[model samples]
Target: MALSARELWRILEPVHGMIYFVPEAQERFAALGLDRMAGYFASRAAALGPVSGEVVVATFYNFNPVIVHAAVPAAWSVTTPAALVEARYEAVGAALRRGLGELADDVSELAGLVRGAAERACEVPQGRPLFAAHAALAWPEDPLLVLWHGQTLLREFRGDGHVAALLLEGLSGIEALVVHAASGEVSAEALRRSRGWSEAEWADAVEGLRSRGVLDAEGGLSEAGLAVRARVEGLTDSAAEVAYAGLGEGERERFVELARPLSRAVVASGMLPFAKR
Candidate 1:
């Protein structure tokens, strides 16, 4: 069977979100005296080679622009480049350490599996700028940590590509969230509040999408909406393929096979919120 977009996401999303849910990572960030650091890490990581906050906001289209702006202050004032990069590496190292410790019995096997995915993922070109920058960094001494970084690289690569696809499809940040809500990935109210968009702004976005045939009066996806979403996903998969270039059908299947168990472990560890549909 061909490697589908949904399967690739299944293999990658857990690895991406695991860092945020890991206690070791949270503790490390707290120790460093950081507040709301997700945007900070994303901005710093995507700099590739010294980019500005404006650039980051423009590229990271799905997030609340305010979130990006909030990160800018910390990125410029609270930390030096060397220090930030060190914190990133150390925090990831610590999280993986704790995580592996928790999964002690399966450490060796998990390491080999994650390492193989990383190796295969590395064979693809780093198509997204953020992914390219992260990929350019030195690999960690521990094989597991290296795999974590590799997974992160792939995740961000696809994220950047997704943003590009959204823009190409003419969806605004709020509109994108509205479409997501329409598809039941999340609730529109929750997304609006979380993204800090005003009720009026959210309503306007919903109206825009409805007018565009991407959403119906009830704020659910219309058939046209589904097609649009599918196109965006298709573009994302195509863009992400550069990273899996060397992996053939068999290799891709094997890579997913290796990563599945680790993905399950990550979910079981309570590092990701699994939405039961």
Candidate 2:
């Protein structure tokens, strides 16, 4: 698609949330199967680096620390029925319980690791705090399901300056930027009416988003951008396992690195998204 100048600029610019969901996120759900969880993790690791993986795992443990932590040691158990997998599960559980305990007590340290990792790997912009965007794209009505979700993501970062409106301009017809506003799904028509812009003016706005790299003709986010947005959110979701316990520096960094390649593999194969895949 022939993007306008604004569009091109938007595409080139750093989006606050594009670098999410990477390959390594799968480990966050190694036992249950990655599904959307895998792709989401990969995207984050790619953008934020491999360290965030710990954050993701911490979240995972919070949700069901007992179960997820147990998955590992179970494989090495020595008892008749429990020796193989059950023992191994217990071993893994013991280690996680301790890791989670220490992190639950330290906030500054965890924030420091997040800050350093955010700055180092994500190349965070000058100001503001950027947490992963939290949203549920699709879900199953079935109550039996208790595994990963199939929701791709877009993060919200601290841009150097105001860019949401600019992003709208850049997407234009080339890329229809979509945001679930309070009213409903915000789309081009909605922007046109609310902004009171002529077709030319709207096109101009979209052009801007494209240039910033927030909007692209192929899709809203570029490959790397999508990776970042997805990765951050994925980690956040993975962290659910651990809940308030959060993550420490070492563990968070470790996860980000390990999940990188696996996330890529799932996305590349088109099996990351639960429903479509």
Candidate whose lDDT is highest: 1
Expressed as tens digits, the lDDT of each residue in 187-206 for candidate 1 is 77878876678889888888
Worst 10 residues of 2 by lDDT: 143-152
So what's the TM-score on candidate 2?
0.21
lDDT per residue as tens, model 2, 1-277: 2222222122212211112222222333333333343333333322222333344334221112232233322321211211212222332233222323332232333234233333332332332112232211122222111001111111223221123322323322223323111113345565454323466755665566456665467435555445544453344333222211233544544434432332333333443232122
Off by over 4 Å in 2: 1-147, 150-201, 204-245, 270-277
Q: Which parts of model 1 are misplaced by more than 4 Å?
A: 37-51, 100-127, 274-277
Models 1 onward score TM values of: 0.83, 0.21
- Alpha carbon deviation, residue 38, candidate 1 (Å): 6.2
* Cα lDDT, all candidates: 0.66, 0.31
Q: After superposition, how far is residue 18 of candidate 1 from its true place, in Å?
A: 1.7
